[model samples]
Target chain A: MSTFSKTRPPLLETTRPTADQTVLRVTDLTTGFRRGATTTEVVRGVSFDLRAGRTLVLLGESGCGKSVTARSLMRLTPERAVIGGSVQLGDEELLTLPLADVVRRRGKRIALVPQDPAGALSPLRKIGSQVSEVLRVHGIVGTRQERTGRTLELLDRVGIPDPQRVAGSYAHELSGGMRQRVAIAIAVACDPEVLIADEPTTALDVTVQAQILELFQDLQARLGMATLLVTHDVGVAERMADEIAVMYAGRIVESGLAETVLSAPRHPYTAALLRALPVPGVRRGELQPIPGQPSAPSERPAGCPFRTRCDFQHDACSEYEPPLFVTDVATHAACDLMRPSQQAVG
Target chain B: MAAPEFLLEGRGLTVTYGNGVRAVSDVDLTVRHGEIVGLVGESGCGKSSLANTVLRMVKPQSGTLSFNGKDLLAMHGDELKAVRRSLQVVPQDPSTSLNPRLTIAQSVEFNLKVHGWGRRERRARVMEMLDRVGIPASYSTRYPHQLSGGQLQRVAIARALVTDPSLVVCDEAVSALDKSVQAQILNLLAQLQRDLDVAFLFVSHDLTVVEHVSDRVLVMYLGRIVEEGPATEILTAPRHPYTQALLASIPTRGQQRAAIHGEPPSPVNPPSGCGFRTRCPYAVDACAGYDNTPHAVGPDHAARCVRLDDLALTAPQAWRNS
Candidate 1:
C-alpha cells in the first residue's frame, strides 16, 4: 500500500556498506574562528567514532563548543573559520575531500537535522515540495508521481497524523513538533549513512521533545544509520546516547559508554554537572552549583580549563593539562585526579 | 476580620485578552510570605496571565485581587504605584531586560533611583546587592554585552530586588541560561528569597525546575489550575491525570520514555469541559461537559476530575519511579 513497501525498505542496501559497524571515525578535530587579530579555538583536539545505529552525543553547555564541533563534522562552518581534523567515512576522508564531493555527500551520505526546524525549513515552499526536492536533487526517486507519493510516505513514517494534509501545508501552518517531524522526514529521505541531529528538540515543548526523541530512536533502529546527536540537556543525552562525550571549553573532558560515565564520572566537571542538574527527588535548595563561569575559548588558562571552577583542584591541575585517562571501568576522563599517580578527586 | 495569612491572594480572577482569547479563566491563586509558589504549564496555559494579574499589569475583567493585605485592584494613581513597587518581576530574558548602553551598576541603580532613593544610598545599596548576587564590584562597571548570560541574570535579579520588593515574581528568569548557569541563578534566587523574606511566584515550563524551587506547585492547563498542592505531594502523588501525564512525560523521572502526545487545545476555543481531555490518556466520555471542578484531595491539595474516586483506586502515585 505504501510507496516503499514493494521496492525498498528504508533504502538500507544503498547506504549501509556493512551492517551495524563503525561508519564514521573522527580524530583530533579542531575548529577555530578569526576575529580581528586573534584566532579563537572553539573545538580543540576532539576525537570520537560514530557506529551504525548508535548515538554518540557531544554533551556540553552553550559556550562549550559542542555545536561548533557538530558543525565542523558536517563541514558546515563559515568560510572564515579554520577547521582541522581527520574525519573518516569508510575509505574517504571527509575533511580533505573536494568542495563538490563534500556537497554531494552532505545529503546523500551525511545529512543534518538542525535545531530549529522552523528556521531550517523553507518558509516559502510547501512541506511535500521540500522533501521531494531533496529526493529529486539526489536522483533517488524518478517522476513527479513517485516523488509525491514518497514524500507523503516519509511524512507518515515520521508520525505526522495526516500525511496527505501535511504534505500540502506550509511550514508555518504546522506546529513546532510537526515542523521537526517534517525536517526528520527530509533528512532521512536519501538514507544517509550518518545523521547529525543538532539540538533537534531544544526549541520544542518538553512533551513534544520526548516524542521527537522516540521518533529518532525508532528511525535509527529501522534505518540503521550512525547518529551523532548534539545536546546540552543531560536527560536527552542519557535517553539517546549509547556513548557520551562530555565537552568543556573546546575540548572533550570525558568520554565512554553512557552507562559507565553517567553513573560514576571520573571528571570533576561531569560529577559537578550531574549533581547540579535538578532531578525529580533532589529536595529544594540542595543543588551544588559549580562556582565561577566557564572560561571562553580564547581565555583558557595555562593548564586545565576547568581548574578555576573545579573544587578538587590540586597543584598538578594548574601546572599540566591532564590527558584522557581510561579508568579500570573503561570510562575516559581528562583530569589530573583521574591520573594513576594522583589520588581520587574527593 | 482576622489578618490574612497569605501575602497575595486573588479570588475568581478572569483575564481575557483583546484577541478573543481567555488567557486566565476563573483562577483562584494565593502566595504566602517568603514562600515559593511555582506556576507551571506548557505554552498558552495562562500561567503568565496569572503572574501579570498578581503584578497588576493586566486588570482582570472579573476578580478581587489583594496584595500585602490591601486591595490592589481598587488602588489608583500614586497609591497603586507605591503598592506595585513591592511587586517587582524578573523577566524571562536577562539580556533584553537590561539596557545595552547601561553598565551593570547603572542598571541595578536605575531601579533604586525610580523608587526615589538618594544617589549615595542607591550607589551603596547597588554594591551590596551586587556582592550578594556574586557579581564583583570591579565588573559592575562593565556593559551588558561584556557580561556572560549567568552574570547578566545576576545583574537582572539585583535590579529587581534593588527596590526591596516583598514579592519578586521570577518569570522564567533562569530559562535562558545554560544548565550550570541556571543552577547558579536558582541557588542565588533561593538564598536571596530566604535572606530578604520575599515571596516568589516562580513561573516555568520545566517541571524539574518548578519542582526544585517551588514549595507549592500550581499546574495550569488551558487557563485553569488542574492541580495545586505541596511540591512533593503534587509531583510525587499527583491526583490529577493531567499532572500525572506531565510527570510521566519527563524522561528523567517517569516511564524512561515520554508517552504524552498531541498538542494542547486552542485557548480561544478550548474543549467544552476539560481542556486537558483532548491529550489525556485516560480521557472518557464522562469528561465531556464535566464542569472540571476542583475537589480537595488533601490539606491544600486539590484536583479537577470527575473520576478522582475511581483514580484513587488505580493511579494514586505520581509514577516518577515507574
Candidate 2:
C-alpha cells in the first residue's frame, strides 16, 4: 500500500480544484426505460461531482447501473427512456437542454470514450477520418489539412507510435490497444471539459490496459480535464481515482477520498468488493465471496438494496432505507452500520 | 532424481491455421497428477490453440500428445472416444457453451448418457454432481437462461466433472465471471482438485487468478513459452523480460502500475531471433541473431532468453525503487 504513495505523490495537492470549481455536477440523476407497460428504473439517483483535473470513479459490478449513470450524463440512453434529475456542466443544465443543444454540446464540451473500442469505432472508415470527423463536426479546426494534422497530433499524444501509418489503417487493421488509443484521441480532439470514459480498458489485456490507464493520467495532467471513469474493477478504481463513489443497485453506496475509502471502506458492500479481489500478496482460498448475486433493477429488494447479500444485516437494515451517513469530514456511506443506534451491533 | 509421473504430456506441439498463420510452435508442456498448471498470455498468444490441441479439438501439425500413458495422436475411433471420457473441458462462456434448448438436468445427464450411463444411475449422478457444485437439485429442471452467469458456470463444471475425469482443461473458465463469482469458482476448483485429484490445464490472461490457483505457471509470448517455473518463484522472481513485464502490468490494489510498451508482434511473421525482442527494453544487437532456448534460472525454473547470462533482471518494483 505504501508503494503507491512512494511512487506517485498525491497529484491532488497541486491539481485539486478549490471550492465552487466543479466541472461537472450531477445531482440525483435517475434514468428509466419503458418496455410495453412495464417501466424499470435502471439508475436510481446517482450523484457525484467531478472537479477540474480530478478523477471520480464510479466503481461497481456488472448491471450495477454504473454504465447507465455515465450514459445518463450524456443523454445517451435509449429513445423514449424517462430521465430525471439535474446534470449541470458548469452553469449549463444538460438534462433540460433541447435535443439540438445537447447534440451540439456532445463531443465538443462533454465527450465520451465508450467501452468496446472495436464496436465504438466504424470498421469501414480509416482511423484518421474517424478522428477528423469529431474535429470537423465540432469545428475545432479550419481546413482539411488542419484536421489531418490535428488528428495525427492527437494520435501521437495518446502514445501511438508511427502515427501516420496508424492514421491510414482501418479499425479492423489496428490492434486492440491501437483502436483504444484512436478512441481516446477522438474523445480529446476538441479538448472537452469533461471526459466520461465507460470501462474504457475492460476489453484490453493487462499490459495494454496499464498503458491505456497511464495515458489517461497523462492526458488529464496535460489537458486538465475532469475525468469520470466508470469501471467494475476495484483495482483500477484504486489506482486511477482521486475520489471514489461506490455504486450498487443504481445508487451510490459510499463516497470519499480514494485513500480513505479504499483503506477503510465504511459501507459493507464496498468492503465486500475490496475483499473479493484476489490481491497479489494474499494467500489462495482466503478470499471471501459476497453471498448471492447482484439483483437487477426489476428485482431490487425493499429498503437497502444490498441487505439481501449483506452479512451484517439486522432488523433495521431491511426496515428502512438508509441515507448517506457522514462517517468523517469527507467520507459518507449509505449503510445502517453507520447509524448510531445500529453502531453498537456492528 | 526419480522420474515424475505425467498425466498429460505434449512434445514439440505445433499448430498452424488454414490461413498459413502459425498459432503454436515447438512447445512442450506436461501436467502431473493432482497438479494445476496455469497457461497465461495476452490474447492471440496461442494459449487457447495449445489447450485445444491437447483436448483433441484441434489437430496439431507436429506433436506427440499422450494422456494417461496412451498415445493420444495415435488413438483411433473407439480408442479416442474411450480416452475422451477421462479428458474433459470447461470452456470460457457458460451461456454459449451450454445447450439453451435443454434443461439443466438434461444437459448434465447428456454427458453421462453419451458415456453410456443407465437412466437411474444418470439421474442420481446428475443430482449429486449438481449438489457438489453448489447448485440446488430443485433448479435442475430450469433452462440455462433462467440461471445467473455464476450458476450456469457451476452447471458447466458439474457436467464436465460428472464423469470423474482424470484431467480437465479449463479455458478461461472464470474470466467472464464477476470478481466474487470468480473467487467462488476458483475455490470450488481448488476443492474439487483436492478431492478428485484431477490435473487442470488452466488457461487465462489474468496473472492474479493464475498465481492464486496454479502450482506451476507458464508464460507465453507470440506463440512461444517464454518462461516456465513454480508459480511462487515465477511470480516473485521472474527470469524472463516478458514475464517481468507481464507481472508489472497487473494493477494490484494499492501498487503503482508499470506499463509495457507497444503491442505484441504479429504471429504470422514474428520478429527473428526472440519473439519479444521488438518490445524488450533490454534487447541488444546480439539478441537479433541469438537462438531461443531454455536457460535454467533455478532447479525447477527455466526461461527462453538469450540475455539470461549477462543481464540482470529485476521485478517492476525494483525499477521503481532504483
Report per-candidate DockQ: 0.55, 0.47
List of clashing residue pairs for candidate 1? none
Candidate 2 TM-score, C-alpha based = 0.94
User: Which CAPRI category fits model 2?
Assistant: acceptable
Top candidate (TM-score): 1
Q: Candidate 1 lDDT, tens digit per residue, A1-53?
A: 22332343445456475555989999999999988888888988999989988
Identify the runs in model 1 with alpha carbons over 4 angstroms from their true place: A1-15, A343-346, B253-257, B312-322
Docking class of 1: medium
**TM-scores across all candidates?**
0.95, 0.94
- CA-based DockQ, model 2: 0.47
